[model samples]
Target: MKDSDSPRRRWWHVDPGGALGGLLLAVLSATPSLLPRAALFQGLITAVAFAVGYGVGTAAWLGIRRLVPMRSRPILWIAYGVLWLVAVGALSVLAVAWQNEVRRAVEMPPLDAVDLAGFLLGFLPVVVILIAVGKLNRRVFRALQRMSGTPVALLGTLTALIAGIAATVLVVMFGVDAVYKGLNGAPDAEAVEPSSEFRSAGAGSAIRWEDLGRHGSAFIGGGPTASEITALTGVEAKDPIRVYAGLESAETPEARAQLVVDELERTGAFDRSVLVVATTTGSGWLEAQTVDAIEYLHAGDTAIAAMQYAYTPSWVSFLFDPDAPVESARALFDAVEERWSRLPADDRPELIVYGLSLGAHGGQAVFDGLGDLRSRADGAMFVGSPNGSALWRTLQGARDPGSPVWQPVLADGREVRWISRAGDESLLPGPWSEPRVLYLQHATDPVTWLTPELIWSPPEWLDPSQRADDVSPEMRWIPVVTAVQVGIDMLGGEAVPARHGHNFGDVVTTGWREVAGDAGLDQAAVDRIQEEIEGYAPIQPYLE
Candidate 1:
């Protein structure tokens, strides 16, 4: 109060109330997202801030008059303000950094403009509430001010500081623990160990499940009968394993598939197996057009699964046995076999499944469909999937009976080997196909941010028609368009509609690669596959 009161005299005020007000403000600010009445809360918070300033100022003035020898008062108060400001700045940085790291580890989507705006607005009330608390606690401020010159003041300050430090430490520790248990969806780190028996043909890296969560492909029915699996690889075709990867767009799968095919061909694996590119252009709104184009390069079929694409629960209806995961899985296998039986021998291909986000969950459905295909035909691959949400609940100890992870499954009639990547926070009722899983991951991928318990509620306002169109100016620059188009062409220009964003390319690559060895895919074979992917459209976007 004195600092603003007179220019002639060096003066200062120590408002113990300011500290209290600040504490209250911080607590309130921390809950911006949960606030029920934004406008009312903000006004009350601001009012409290002003009151805290007034109380702290008045208390400081009176305490100086009652105790401080006249001249030294201003200097002490100035020092107090400086120290507080530094402390506040340091705390702010810590909070922001922690939030960012937590977000990344759990596979949460990047913050949008709305999230940023909310953050900015959220802090005002916090500061105001803290200031208000300080203002109301006049007696507390006066007590501290009276002892300003004595060792008592130091002791009092130390006590307050200690309490604050303890509270801060507790908050941080609790936040981290909560996030670790709830948001970090990965299995216990101790649970993951290296496997020596399973090996990817060309990957120089160690296989880890976390990496599989980030990247892996599950193949569905094998390529179309018209396509020559033998031509793609010099080896005679054994079983046609179809591939599927579910993502918002098909770009990731297409790119990874081409890379895998090329690598396999160069390594001579293709000489033994034929690995043709294929895509599953789901018959959802956004999928049809994209799949039709993708068809030219990647061989794929467009299958519409009704509204289940948007309402994940609808997968229950498609399951072989809605009441039991194991039974459902077996039923799915029967359906696949039944379908294969009907197809002219040459038209039927083996099936594998791959997915990411929603697609990953859908992969679980495929596994359910072809329960024991590995023993009968080939294997499966799954990537970037959350176990409960997308992959139905089929594994042991399933918490959600309707979990998507179990949807694509077959009965345990035979063993199926699976390849996966790390940073996939997907939780399952149990481990993957026993004794046959390989996982991989990159250290920097943000998908690591996900925890099993963390739930992401998509905004209900998103309109299906507003989805980005390949020809739209906004989407023209996106590389994924070309990849999706590859899948679309595979489906003869049919497209899956979109309510939820789906990535077809990611599904294709991951699924096919898992069963690649069985097909004997290799480098030269991949080049031919790449040519087909590039040949789909009249103009090659990759060339540009």
Candidate 2:
């Protein structure tokens, strides 16, 4: 044995006990997963296996020390570093892959910045365990050397139990909140069939109150089904269709668009489809999508349970680089066009484009980006549009400033109906002469008045115009809170955003019948909607 003052003993020595402790810490960090039967089990098992392998590796290090008898320690440290890198890196990559696969299989919405926060924090236990175990192992080893017959086995067992309990407690306490929030964050159901068993479901006239609740608890909200939105639009089998929706604060166009796709599938009316791209500013419109879906909510299920997927490439961040969104929107449109392009080429599908707020601005961007592609589509509609008077701004750069070829008039000379809502002056008049545009105004919405955050933009064309000015900062808080209270009163487990909006959507949908009939759109299919809309009499101003 070397002298007590030797450099190896004092500073440069390797501690096998410390290595064992580090390995134990890794295994302990991964062990609790066995109880949950999570999809992460394979990755966790692999990590534990790596830890055991690392502990066994210490024997190789000892053998090297005895055989080579080298004074320099560089090789040993390098080997250890390489081992750690390979083992830890493999585990990390596997964990991410496993997580992504499982999440995708269920069509879980993309995790927002807030959702990942707990996963980010889960690293703390490993650091703490490594520190505690290192010190404890060193002290225990020193004691063994000083004593005659110290029970090393007992010491190792105690260390493992301590590490295991610490890791379990920390992971459980910190991880549970995040996991629950993540699972609950997405809208609940993919669809709801109200007529089946939910014939009598809804809150009583009395106002109840509560806040957040667990998944099945009588207090949460969800997204709506495609059927509900279609029912609300009241688009008869024959009339042209217009779709209006928004991107959630935490949802993307891709995710929300999935719901739209499902709606189209159910309607079987997408022989021609128009896309109204939006910039990110008016993402609040996604709430309208939720409302559309909610109209079909049932008593026992949450609203969002009916939603199939969330939209993606959310407009909020897409607004950062206006050009970037233009490119992406163009690509999306092109892909959609291509999907429909080959079907009966001679009889081309009539296509149009329009959007309002962020979508309107973004739609303009898409037009500018596409150049010739705009001509491919037939007509467009914009509400609360952002394009200026210039042709480039208005027509997505499709029409030239002085093009006589594009007539802006109808045969009978009524306006072409380029309806502008919410008083957006930036959406100037078309240079095209004589009735090429129509303006739809809501007196309450301040965005048209350029009021900053003072009013809520109407959630949908169907929402009561009176509610547009509901600018309470707490509007965001009310839905979640109201859902809980309303859900309990209704005897439902939890109310989703989609479910809560059901009444709103139902009122809007059923009311459309009157709107169509008054407009002389009365047909057999549209009678139900017209009667509902006419009955309310309250939503008239908003509809008009």
Number of clashing pairs per prediction, in order:
144, 47
lDDT of 2 at 484: 25
Model 2 residue 476 lDDT? 25
lDDT at position 364, candidate 2? 52
- Strongest candidate by TM-score: 1
After superposition, which runs of candidate 2 have C-alpha atoms over 4 Å from their true positions?
A: 1-185, 188-328, 345-349, 369-374, 387-416, 420-445, 448-544
Per-residue lDDT of candidate 1, residues 124-161 (tens digit): 55545554454445445555767676788768776896
lDDT of 2 by residue, 1-544 (tens): 5574463454444354345444544443332110111223333333443344444555465565576545556776777678766766665554454444423322234333443344434444443444445445656656655653556865765687689889998787556435534543333354221221111111221111111112211111223334542354443222222222222211444444443334333333344322222222221222233122113211111111111111222222232334434443454455445544655765534444434333444455554333353354444333333323223233323333332211112222232322222223223344433212222222212222222111333222212332322122112212222222222212111111111211122222222111111223334433444343334322211100
The local lDDT score (0 to 100) that residue 302 gets in candidate 1 is 21
**How many pairs of residues in model 2 come into backbone collision?**
47
